[model samples]
Target: MILADIPIPDLELEAHDGIDVPHDLVALSEPLEPGQMLLLRTLDGVHRCAEVVGLDFTENETIYRLTYGAPMAPEIAAAVARPPRSALRHWVDDIDVEVLLGELADAARRTATTSQAAAPESSW
Candidate 1:
């Protein structure tokens, strides 16, 4: 899948860079489905990928629980590896849902290819 093939929503996020590690506070217009991958851009211009595990609303604010993963850009991998904390309450307003979806499709393709290569050939 590509960026043009997916439907994306407009979201507004509050910037939170109080500490050395920068993250965003995202308020989703709609509830995110489970296992949805998101592409977040940090305040310092780093692109990171995360999978949405759960969502909760508190005090009229939607909180998304994400499991942080590898950096999209190789240059910032080292920086993203070391973070000040691992809390998952922050949100970012600007994200390319299309790009995130594309990445997910690509990953799935790679996994399928690897599995096919490893499987033994059938005589049928």
Candidate 2:
């Protein structure tokens, strides 16, 4: 099994659908396999978990493709990044986590179907 311990300054989901970490850039040993687990740890203690959907091997590096939900909703990210706060009628409460999550999953599924029909994205 491939093992990786990634540490990042920040976890950026937007601007790039999936991240490309040079095999030398992180504590990555061995090539990753499809369906393997990927754990991303951000500087602010915000951790995102994902499963490896694809793997590209370069001369000396491996690129992991791990998301269909390219850019997560800013609101969801913001809420998860904050420290727990018990406030009345807070913005966090206003967010319907379930609905937002359902929509996100559906959108991701659609995107995946469409993308699969097109040429595969280059993994640099």
Candidate 3:
């Protein structure tokens, strides 16, 4: 069965220059669904192909950060520098707080189980 089509906020991504690395990271304005790809463009004629390789969830927004395959434009680097301070804005109006809390509980349980399994028994 198909889930109801919900409009996703367009990914207004900004390129983050890797300080000590060769690649560049882009911050997505919206979370990319599984198996989705993107063709990104800029007004000054810059263009790139991208896909979400990783995601970081915050209290309100789930960030779909990606690495641009080629070197990012200087304009993009400037944009990246400016947004980090305010990227984590709160937008939990329609979000279910309980569901978010439940994820934390699940994470804690998973961590506890993994640590217990990894722990080695010692002789008394």
Candidate 4:
């Protein structure tokens, strides 16, 4: 989920370079049923967010309908195709890339610790 969609009160995002942008929730339900994708355009770049209604990942890359709104501008699309920091102001909100990355790393560490604790210790 993009930070823009996060239900934080008055939550505004700041880009890695310190820029703000606007966003809206665009969902594809009918033609794109059994799944939904969210597109966010921020000052940094465009982001693709999706949720599949059914759990199935036996394929190389899970195939789900691309149901989301994205920038149509060639330049914007090109930027979005590159990195989150390359998207412009549209569906995504600008956020601090370093901060977000740090948060993700911390979460990963916590998850790893939790998994290790839950695993049975075996001494050979």
Top candidate, metric lDDT: 2
User: lDDT score, residue 6, model 3?
Assistant: 15
* Model 2, residue pairs in steric clash: none
Model 3 clashing residue pairs (backbone): none
lDDT of 2 by residue, 3-111 (tens): 2345655445535555766556655656566787655544544445556787788786687776424333433444444444554655644456675577667766866
Q: Assess every candidate by TM-score.
A: 0.38, 0.41, 0.31, 0.31
In order, candidate lDDTs are 0.46, 0.56, 0.43, 0.39
How far off is model 3, as Cα RMSD?
17.8
Q: Per-prediction RMSD in angstroms?
A: 16.1, 13.2, 17.8, 16.4
Off-target runs (Cα >4 Å) in candidate 3 are 1-31, 71-124
* Backbone clashes, each candidate: 5, 0, 0, 12
lDDT of 4 by residue, 1-124 (tens): 2222322222233212112211222222222335433334444444433333442233443333222332234333333334455456444444555555566666667667878999998998
Worst 10 residues of 4 by lDDT: 15-24
lDDT of 4: 0.39
Judging by TM-score, tell me the better candidate of 3 and 4. 4
Off by over 4 Å in 1: 1-24, 74-124
Error of 4 at 38 (Å): 3.8
Give the local distance difference test score of model 2: 0.56
Write candidate 1's Cα lDDT for 1-124 as tens digits: 0001112121212232111111124534445555776555554444555566766666655566655444355333333343323256354333444544566666667767888999999999
Assess the local accuracy of residue 60 in candidate 4 as a C-alpha lDDT between 0 and 100. Answer: 44
